[model samples]
Target: MSELIPAQQLRYSAQLLLPEMDERQQQRLFASKVLIIGLGGLGSVVASYLAGAGVGQLLLADDDRVSLSNLPRQLLYSSAEVGLHKVDCAKARLTAQNPEIAISTLPKRLTLAELQVLLPEVDLVLDCTDNASSRLAINQACYTQQVPLISGAATGWQGQLLALKPWLGQGCYQCLYPDWQDSPSCLQSGILGPLVGMVACQQALLALQYLLNIGVIPFGHLRYFDGLQGTSGQLQLQQDPDCPVCALNE
Candidate 1:
């Protein structure tokens, strides 16, 4: 509920010269509160980029700790942090990166009830988390709150990014993964380190664009990238008429 932190002192050269960005858009981004549900590979980059870009406040929720295998991606921590709580370490790194922004770290497991409690205070929600249960909960929260949800997933050499804004006519995450069944994650398939960063960065861009409501167009379609052979493709995603979340009224 606090006022948005001003970005005038922290504006970077890239944002200053961007013809598409103006003071109003920058302020809107600064006023946005983005809730990131993970502290792993994708969540790490998304948090770093958004904080560096001067987002106003952050509601960080992660119930994991740094592990030996997480070294390659989760860049917010050092080797010494192998046993420390992930959200604790991430908060320290992010605050050091830009103390001007407000950060609220919740090092607790989040359920649908918890998400709904936090949903109303934020503008956008980014699901960098790796499970369908969490992603589905986030989708429902966003749809019910009329907040935009930017979702991303990565495994091996494959990556997917989609933004769901039910208030604006786009489909929710459930529209794509309706069954919402639990599936294998990077930990199971071994994701390439860089793939997580790329996917997280795209998620950040989508979140910023949605918050700014600038000239940026919503990616109504789904994007697929094959890091193996450098091949990528996208196919338009039609709104499922019977989607339980995106089209609950029907």
Candidate 2:
């Protein structure tokens, strides 16, 4: 792994010395590639941490642009970045934060076909998109590709995270939400500015842990958090024996 990444001095030194995560874990993160959808609130934070930790490649995808309203929470963008493509803005900020990171910008919407083209090359998929339709598409793609998916949502101080390791014994995202109903986007409901960053950064932490092969998986369970109350917790993970995807595979 050290041979894979020679830029030791550029980044990853502090991570190697961290108590639970050793040099091996740091090297693992350095060698991994991750794809993040929607370079907005969640995606911005996710990109920051992964690049900061020195993920070898980042497939940054988003078709939106920074707007005046986005400046409150989308730290990757500034007043100057408004009207610029989200992926370009994100790439500029993330690359400047760590020049060693290999970041690619795809400023386009993710159709099922487009997702299939991208997901296979990525070691892991992080869904930072705002809508449930996009989330389910990402989930199904990962399930088919045998890739792990890290998903998080935040709106108005409430947020949750769920991990779908399809290749593992755990169930995929659709298995957990089999009904497949569409949910309200943050724009519709009006999200709290800072909470988006919190949830996104948390998702990034879990992503890094998974890539580094360190923390325990939150399979079949959801971790919920409320920033207004300063509270957080996890709920039980129930496997559906009749889940269309997981059951058939099992």
Candidate 3:
């Protein structure tokens, strides 16, 4: 690992102070690469936190352009950026926030094949996409590549997060939502802005923990949040014996 320069040490001084995150762990963060799929509500927060913490490289993928509706939850983009590609706008904002980290942008949605191609280059993947189909595709790619996945979603006043390490014989996103069908999205069902922010922040925290190998990994479990009630719960997940995506790994 490359030594932390004086500026980096000062930038991450608070994190370096944590017993579990010292100079060595800070260096690990600086050397890490993260791929964030979807530059929406969840992706925006995940990208901001990760970039601010000095993740070495960030690959942002999102084909959608910023819209008036996205300004509420997707905090990375401004009103002036409306109609601009989300990845490009996010790249500009995140770059300004942390000029030291390398920021790469994919101004389009990724096919499963593209995800497979990119997964190998990153240490972790964050599924910040809002749709089930996208999440499932991301899970499959992560499982195939044996990369850790931090998945999160929010709809209406609720959200859920799960970390999957299928290579560890754990249940993947598909195992949790087998026989999935199209579900109501934020556009149709409506969403609470803070709710998405909270969930995305949790995803960011889980990503950091997974990357640094600190704390208990939340794999094989789901964390659900209810913004209306302001409460949360956990569900332990089990691998399906017949799960197509993860059974082979087992």
Candidate 4:
């Protein structure tokens, strides 16, 4: 591992102060690479935290453009960037937040083949996309590559997070939701701004822990949050023996 320069030491001083975080851990963070899909509500917060935490390289993928409607939960953009592509706006903001890290932008949706090609170089992936198709695709790719994945979602003052480590021989996102095709979206159910942030923060925290090999990660577990009631819960995810996705891995 490369030694932390004076600049890095100063920049990551807060993290370095943590008992579990020393120069070596800080250096590990600097060496890590993360791919964040969807530059929407969840993705925006996850990207900001990971970049600010000094992740070495960030690959941002999102084909959608910013809009006035995104302003509520997607704090990464402003009114000035409403018409621009989300990845472009996110790249600029993330770069400005931590110029020390490298940001790569993919202003398009990725196909399965494309994800396979990209997953090998990535250490972990964050599935911040709101749709089920995107989530299932991401889950399949990460499982195939044996990469850790952190998936999150929020709607109507509620949020949920799930972490999957394919190599751990646990349940995947597909196993948790076998029939993900006809799920309701934020557009129909509506969502709260802070609800997304809360979920995103948890996703980011789980990613950091997985990357740094710190605390125990709830792999194959679904964590639920109810902002309206100020309560939370968790459920252990079960792998389906009949799951087609899992059969592919076998």
Candidate 5:
């Protein structure tokens, strides 16, 4: 890896100040490649923070277009971009935020085969998508590739975040939701705008910690945030003996 230039060092001075972060870890972040699925509320926050923090390469995938209603929680797009594709809008915003980092986009929803192909190229996967089907597909792809996954969801006053290190025989998203039925989304259930941000921030922190090897990876555990009560809790997740996706790996 190349040494950080004077400008780069100054750009990331805050993160570099941490005892767990140094030139080496900064370089690791700069060399890391992350694939983020979804460009809605959670995806917007996760992409913005990771790009701002200097994650080397980001591959954004989302087929949805920006809607006027999305402006409340999806922070990346402006009113003028209402009709544009989300991945395109996200790419533009993230690039403008950090020109030094490489940003790529797949403007269409990825099929499972496509995800499998892309998984091997990325160091980590962020399942920022809202629906159950997308999340299940992302999990299966990550499990097959043995890549780390940071999954997050927020609806109404509640939010959930989980990090899965599938290679370690840790529980995966499927272990938590065995039935792949469509669940209520923010659109139907009505979401708290700040709740998405809170979950996304946690997801970004987990991704950074995993990439930089800074702290415990939180595998097989879920963090729940209650926006209404202003409290948080953790749930110890266990690998399912019958999890179709991960049981074979274990």
Candidate 6:
């Protein structure tokens, strides 16, 4: 950990002013590494905030290309980038946002084995994928590596968030959705832009808190946000006795 340069101090002065944040915490954020899967609506917001906040290293993975339909919420891409790979576009945008941090791009979906290999190097992970298969795979890998995970989803007028600390043995994502079934994606169900951003911001906020050791983040709890009503609620999660993914950990 090196001292914060004058430029960095000025750039992050707002954060340093917080009682929970100081030069040491700011340096921790600068040295931390985060892996984010999916570059959709949620991924877009999470990646942008983490980058802007000065996360030292970011691993971005998404195989999809930017599409015109994505503009509504995937703010990382533009009309000119509609056919470009999302990871590439995201890398460019995030790098341009903060040239100090390092960014790595994986332009394809990762298999469980791939995630297992990658998770060990990451300090934390953000599961921003929209499907059950991707989310389950990420959860399994994070649990195996004993890394913290922040998972989020949004579709139609609803959004969900979870911060899972696997080593705590509280509960894993599989425990919440034992069947590993996912609802229709935003593509089919239609999503409001702000609805997804709300969840993404929560996901990013939890990540920052976890990394900086600040505030009481609700790990192992499911947070639900109703876009239409503009209200949110939370439910504590419990590990299932029969949850194959996390049962062996107990």
* Count of backbone collisions in candidate 3: 0
TM-score of each: 0.90, 0.89, 0.96, 0.96, 0.96, 0.97
Better of 2 and 4 by lDDT: 4
Candidate of highest lDDT = 6
User: Largest TM-score belongs to which candidate?
Assistant: 6
Candidate 1 local lDDT, 1-250, one digit each (tens): 3433455634554785688776666667777888998989999999999998889898899999899999998889899999999989988999999887898999877989988889998887888787788888888888888777778889888998887666566776777777767767777888888988888988888877777776564556778899888988877667778887777466
Q: Assess the local accuracy of residue 194 in candidate 6 as a C-alpha lDDT between 0 and 100.
A: 90
Lowest lDDT block of 10, candidate 1: 1-10
- lDDT of each structure? 0.81, 0.81, 0.89, 0.89, 0.90, 0.92
CA RMSD (A), model 3:
1.5
Off by over 4 Å in 2: 1-7, 21-24, 167-169
lDDT of 2 by residue, 26-106 (tens): 667667889999887888888988898888899998889899988877878899888999999899999899888798988
Candidates by lDDT, descending order: 6, 5, 4, 3, 1, 2
TM-score of 4: 0.96
Mind giving the per-residue lDDT tens digits that candidate 3 earns over 1-250?
5687898889898888888988888778878999999999999999999999888899999989999999989999999999989999999999999999999999877889999999999999999987778888999999999898988889988899988887677788888889887779798999978999999999999889888999987787899978999899999888888898998534
TM-score of 2: 0.89
Predicted structure 1: lDDT:
0.81
Q: Please give the lDDT score for candidate 2.
A: 0.81
Per-residue error for 78 in candidate 2, Å, reads: 0.7
